[model samples]
Target chain A: MEAPERLGEVVQASTDRFTAQCYRLYGAPPLGSLVRAGEREPHVYGIVSSVTTSSLDPTRPVVARGASEPTEEAIYRSNPQLERLLRTDFEAMTVGHTQDGTIHQYLAPLPPHIHAFVFRCTPDEVRAFTQRLDFLPLLVGARTPPGDEVLAACLREAASAHDQPTEFLVQAGRKLALLLGGEMQRLNTILRRLPL
Target chain B: MTGREESPEVLGPQLLGVVVGGSLSQGLEVRLEDGGVVEELKVGTFVTIRGERHRFFGMVTDLGLASADPRLPSALPDTTNPAIVRILSGTSAYATMQVTPSLVVGGEETSLLLEGPQPARSIPFHFSRAYRASQEDVQAVFGAEDERHIWIGSPLDMEDTRVCLDLAEFVKRSNGVFGKSGTGKSFLTRILLAGILQRDVAVNLVFDMHSEYGWEGGSEEGHAVKGLKQLFGSRVAVFSLDEESSRRRGLSPDYLVRIGYDQIEPQDIETLAEMLNLTQNAAQATYKLASRHGQQWLREFLALEGREELAALADQLGEHQQTIESLRRRLDRLNRMAFLVERSPEDSVRRILEYLDRGTHVVLEFGRYGSDLSAYLLVANLLTRRIHDSYVRRKEQSLGDRAKEPRPLVITIEEAHRFLNPQVAGLTIFGTIAREMRKYNVTLLVVDQRPSGIDEEVLSQVGTRITCLLDNERDIEAVLTGASGARELRQVLARLEPKQQALIFGHALPMPVVVRTREYGPRTYAEFGFREQAELAREAEKDLKDLFG
Candidate 1:
């Protein structure tokens, strides 16, 4: 099998979430995308919840310099040193972990170690991981500010990995309706955002 | 309209759901499966539950919509979106049906085959799967068409599956056919009578008040419907009280029934007192005059024209003068009836008894007299009294010899409440037969629209009650009296279609069933083995020639 492409390295970790810093500037995976850390057993999986591009060091605040340039690309092209000062990183809520070749759609026993390699999951891996919807409640109950939107986007992203995306979204929407019982407003918002 | 081909899979019974909670008295509550659409499941339809130890059969009496959360109604989902509607239907909101389990067959196939179905005394275990009853389940419960079973109709939505009646058990006791006017009560009664004659379980003596059961009757659509005589040929004998009226209807009645003044006993007066508007004292005075004037009391009394002669006779009999005067006034109406002669040459009661004794079913058509309730009450009371007496004497003589026991007689009476009301139910012979309940090998098939007017005691004794749509609360209550699970059956009974549908429950069927009553057209006529009139005449002529040659 081909090796999954590496995207970042885990810079900060916790029992329920982890922060991964991209190797290249502005190279963070899109929000709500599935990504995992660790190259061997006990792979930790999560959904990308948010992304940031800021100074590598907290004390050094980067200043904007594109006002005098004719175009934004020209400003970036003129400032080669800016790439060394800025870094892109994303925060993902830990949704599941794998052990013994069996995927467990729940919190890992221990957080991923810092500096562990993180890779964006392949379409086949995404489909296999989402074969069962047990991990839906984790995404729905996340502490993210726009939790329903994040959950909807994650479903849309996972749906494309399946042969029949509409059927997959409908199944996921029904499960959300059940989990969000009496929360019709939340369910309606999520269903409206579904690709179907 | 949708080009939907009705495949067997779609028409056949599909899995409904599981029995969630219920009791034997209130019926089981079934939570519908996701595939079961609530609108598709109708009330009064048949359902079968596969319990662990038994296969329970029942009717869907009620339907409901429920949700896992009580706030679903106020917090409604987006219904315009088909995806949202589909998703929220079965998961967050679900449908439920209340099933009244009536009969249960055993778990083992061998046991079910040997023992048949029995009343469901206990409920199925929780979560037992309930389904739309299949044709095989219906056949298993209500046996196949055979010598002893008659196909009465098909259950609602199960047009291809026949729900039969046990003819042998049906004739064992008096049954009733009740509904509001114009609800096909007459047609349903005809079907039952035809079935009884076809099965030969018992011989029926019908007092056809409307002249419908003797020859042909017109349906609501003005179509001619055949009567029992036309269907049964030689097995049925038609007796008409109005020969001219029968002839006008193209009927050749076998016998003309004429009641004599002497045959009009004082008891017959008591039965007709309500219909004739006779006062209690006026009705009671007939007995005094009968004892004083002897066998020709009615004829002798009607001869007293002037008030002075009546007063003198009333004083002689020690009755009040005014009471005698009013009694004479009421008895005078009988003189206008052409069927009531001064003295009849032939005994109509004895003729009817002879026909009944020979296993020939008799239908006495009242013809034009059917409009006059008093004439009907008098003749029916007189003839039934004598026939019942003879049956009692014969039944006693054949106590040990079953073969000699008189054939079971089911007397069909229309406008039955007039004879079976509380005032005269005890005094009338029809009421006596209903109460005695086949003791003398005689039963009644009481057909009426106003069951509430019938004596409650008599109504309770009716074995099987097949009723059409009855909007009157009292009538529905009266028909459901003394029935087990009457509360659930009340809902089913009230919802019956105004025509060509009936709720049949009681001694004849294993469970209560709502049926689209079998069509009473050419198909049913063929089923009853009816031959053309010319063919019957030809056969009769052939028999006569062979006998002489």
Candidate 2:
């Protein structure tokens, strides 16, 4: 089951199974974090490919950083009004959605419904999706897709959420070792960043 | 360093970088690890990626330092800010390598380094761990042995490890030793011959073209490198064409190779023409004269003293008068070589065959005659023709007599390109033997520096090629033609040390290997059965004492 907190709402849907639009809430999901949406049995699942925050007003420019701030979290806390001015959005590559209950790693038979309720996938959902690591190749590509950081963040979250954190990491590492035998740099980066 | 070999903590070479990029045709891209704690892999060094059920074998073809952003210079950035320096130092910047997978060996048996199809996927694993191949991995793949296997050289990475070559397969067809001059061609040939001789697999007949295969040959520093005769005395009978030169070198040559001038045929004279600087018409004159006067043509032609008689024969034969004179003048020089006698001496070809039939190796030393091109060509061609013809006949005779198996013979010739060059190959008997001498129980161990000059037909027929450094493009291509994985090995071949390294591949070896050739002096004698020979001699002495004392 997905978490009750709505991570985002599908703002725009596409006939292209690869892409979708989401209006992010106060907390945007981490890159590569598995998410669920769509109002029907064939709910759409995706990995976040990118995340960005922008000013809602067309004429104003927004800046998140300033001097004399102890930390990013402190700035956010001190300026709650900043959130109203700026809205968060994210892009998800629809790797595979679920029909009834089985996970998949291919494009949906049909486009995801518009304005579907999108939410963060629970730890169990993430584990089930990663059962065989079939999604790994879908996320990685040759043309420097900025896939490393996304993969690392997802792996760290998934490993920490598993029953045996270190063992899960080792298992994933072994799978990645075989899957990325020739892609050492990408592999090492993902491996070194495992939460275990 | 502390982990057991089988343990997860196994101490082997570690990764330097991620394989973030590259295509199949261009090659794979790998970033090196941050530091250089591991052994720096050379261009030809082999590395392996451990997949779930398979191990991928790859050769490192190129190494370079690279940056993620092309605009960024690779040099460490010069900056005063400590924070910037710290961040820059930890950046994803380091050495990178281009790796080419030549083989992907994996199966339940795990021993076979199979030349199978490349894996379906370009990358076997998402992030496979790489380690330098272990000794067991190498041995299982390369050191698989059988009775016919002979250890030729050690692998470049594995010290004191012997790499075995399948000799039975190697001797079944012709083979060659090719390299640039001074690249240990002779030394490698000597080791190969030693394997053949010590195994008693075949009898060898070496045409010592430079007088180098018999008692002694010059080393790179001009010191004497011991030759075949010194290494295996009684087993190898060393014969010389020039008796005085042999004696001058203080060698007791087993036989003085003598051929009656009457034995020289029209074809023999034609082969000698290149050395004699004779025109085609002059060479044809010898044939015309031979047909006119039969076996006594040389003597009769020499006996013709008057120009009136020469003019009469020239008119009668429709020959140019000057061509006839030039033929006679060139033919006259043959009398000056000491080895060509007009009359009685032992039949040299018969003697050589008898020795070979008895399974004794023969190295025919040209001695001073080796430098005289005309004499060497005439004698080598005539003798090789006779031996090859007799072997063919003997093979025919033994077709039904399994008990009387014709001894397998391997004829060793230097400057093989001279006899096997395309221009002369059709007429040269050595080329015939090179092309098709297998079923007759004969083969050639052709030693030459210029393999490119050898006839393509003959080169194509050569079974195995053990080449030293060859900078010539054609020679390298000729040696590597039809060899498996030769394209990847070209990088390896180019980097061989000019002295004692050789790249051995083809019919005999399981795979292409670049090895440091075995040292020839004491190490060679020790490893190649000198101790076994001594034990046999001691046992014979004991048996004699037990019978009589």
- DockQ (C-alpha based) per candidate is 0.38, 0.04
Tens-place lDDT per residue, model 1, B344-392, is 8999988998898899999999989999999888888889999999999
Error of 1 at B178 (Å): 1.5
Residue B410 lDDT (model 1): 95
How accurately is candidate 1 docked according to DockQ? 0.38
Q: What's the TM-score of chain B for every model shown?
A: 0.93, 0.86
- Interface root-mean-square deviation, candidate 2: 11.6
Per-residue lDDT value at A53 in model 1: 92
Clashes of each: 0, 21
Report residue A81 deviation for candidate 1 (angstroms).
4.8
